[model samples]
Target: MQATTPLSANSAATAPRTAQPVAARGRLITDAPTRMFHWLFALSFVGAYLTAEGERWRMLHVTLGYTMAGLLAFRVLYGLFGPRQAGLGLLWRKLGSAPAWLKSLRTAGSLTAVNWRQGQNLLMALAVVALLVMVLPLTLSGYATFNEWGVFPGEDWLAELHEFFGEAMLFVVLGHLALIGGLSVLRRKNQAAPMLTGRVDGPGPSLVPHNRRWLAALLLLAVLAYGAWEWQQSPKGLVPANAWSQVPGGEASGGDDD
Candidate 1:
């Protein structure tokens, strides 16, 4: 019988095939309630701002303002008591390392990394803190003005302060948008899409499990119901009595003949 030839390392038949690694897919990061709060908060701000000028829109404006206040309250509670990823504990921990975090940013190759591990965490914490700072003053001043809550400086002063804070908040929001755009471009990620879809591109297991979407839906429904009820009870002078009635010489016009 002929002896079988042994395969050599150089032989193609004997070489083992190398398996290619699978690419990482997107995973759920933000929860449903958090995402809902984000978009609703944005809409409430915009609605309140756009309706600020006219008496006819004041009801809508006040309703939106109250909505914002409620949203902020919910966020505070949620942050304090919510999930691990969404809780204030994480933010507090990250903030506690502020010095080190800032230092890391200054180091070489921080931003250049293909995956900036802590970038999202840092960004979210900073944004949350800044928004809370801005929104508190804006909300308080608005409420005071609407309710005539205090007699300190006077309603005029309160209104002026409200306007100032509103403008400042707008500026902060613009800055936030600019920063988000820059980071998205640098990181090659769709940062805004995460707020809408509650997911981010990355390897799993996800930081948070499946979201409590039902809670988000309930929260939204409650807010809408409250807004509608408030709309009905809101001052008619502020709520548009009639569209045509508010025209220059229409019945709703209160100007006296000169």
Candidate 2:
């Protein structure tokens, strides 16, 4: 072996350092179940709204409404007891930080300078809350109206409330789209792509390695079965003629008309 002289301090200090390799993109972030829930919720809401226009589509509307409700229930359960990143605790923490986040936004020099992760978290939390506000009232009012539950002052009143909630939900959906567009532009990334692909551009181990897609399939099948059962149980006519027996003048009017 050749003998080498000891390097001087300045020589060692000025030596070229090996740079660590940059991490590549395509890290899994959102889980398959959550992604399925997101898309199902969107499609069900749209279907319900579209079918709400005519009595001919009333059964379809009711089925879609029930589907939406079931999806929301599943989502709530998942958020409470699901994966680490998809839990309610994390969302709550993000929502709680909104005040500080907004204050920081006032000082942020640009979109790139802002804490995009926290900003995205805050927006997602707000969107969840907003969607709940829209969906809960819509589902409840629609169900009561359809089933003639009589929980409201009148069926007509419940119908009006259902219409109002539907309109409000449309507005909320528009706002949600606008927010997504703005965030996508600001972050210089397609925000919706992760929802579709369950992946994001980052370097990290997947939050969901296996995705447990079978669980999502099972949940979806159960919801569909419940919806089918509900549809079959619903009255085929506008109102079951026998349902009018309790009303004083209803039976008399029907008999006279007959």
Candidate 3:
């Protein structure tokens, strides 16, 4: 190196001058409505489940169930009219894409790239389906018992069917929790915090899409109103030996005794 040389502009530019990190995008992951629904649903489900058998807790259980039903119904409407990413059409399309990808994988053809969002999208769609199934019977059976519409005509299957679906929901909910825990650990992320705080920190390396706000607000309002109305008609009026209550006898008293 006999001659001192000025650095070439290209080389100088290419050199790693102190690495400057990019600022994170605005905190725009989950909106307030979405986050509120998440926690309320969690609380309602747990309270309802724990209070299932006790008369003292029966009112609370019914109230919570009504709240859950209203929330779910509102969610369905919101998903339809919500933000682009939160729309039902987009979510369902993502779910449908999974089967197509699986088929393509079997065919040995060059497959289109599927992003991380696909996995989360599919999981969410499945959870939605599971929830819908669970809620339909829970709500229907509850109404049936309350209104004295026993067996529901030819749909006598509803009684047993409701019990089965309700129990099945427990498994689906557990699976959801496991999936969340696993994803968070694997990605080194705090996925649950966003639902709690209504804001995600960084766009980190994940496919969790953002939610819309207006639709979420509408949903929350609708659910809260419906829940308040339903809670006012708590199941106490229909209390008896029905499955919801603990009748003085070992067995529930209302069903036909043959």
The candidate that achieves the highest TM-score relative to the unseen native structure? 1
- Model 1 ranges with Cα > 4 A deviation: 1-25, 103-124, 150-155, 235-258
The weakest ten consecutive residues by lDDT in model 1 span 108-117
Task: Rank by lDDT, highest first.
Answer: 2, 1, 3
Of the candidates numbered 1 and 2, which has the greater lDDT value?
Answer: 2
lDDT of 2 by residue, 1-258 (tens): 999989899999999999998767588888888888888889889988877886766877888887888888888889888888778677678789999988988998897878878877688778777886578889999988888776545338888899999998888788888888988898899989989988987766877777878987887788768776876787673243454665687654445422
What lDDT tens digits, residue by residue, belong to model 3 across residues 172-243?
888888877877887788666767765566555433355545655766677667666665675543233355
In model 3, the worst 10-residue window by lDDT is: 236-245
Task: Give per-candidate clash totals.
Answer: 0, 0, 0
Candidate 1, residues 1-258, lDDT tens digits: the string is: 999998776797667789898876578888999999988999999889988886668778888888988899998899888887888677778777777766777775746842355765666577767777788888889888888776575338888899998988787777778778887887788768889887788666777686999989988997889887886686564456575564687676455422
By TM-score: ranked, best first = 1, 2, 3
Itemize residue pairs with steric clashes in candidate 2.
Answer: none
The alpha-carbon deviation from the true structure for residue 85 of candidate 1, after best TM-score superposition, in angstroms, is 0.9
TM per model? 0.75, 0.72, 0.63
Best model number under lDDT: 2
Which is better, 2 or 3, measured by lDDT? Answer: 2
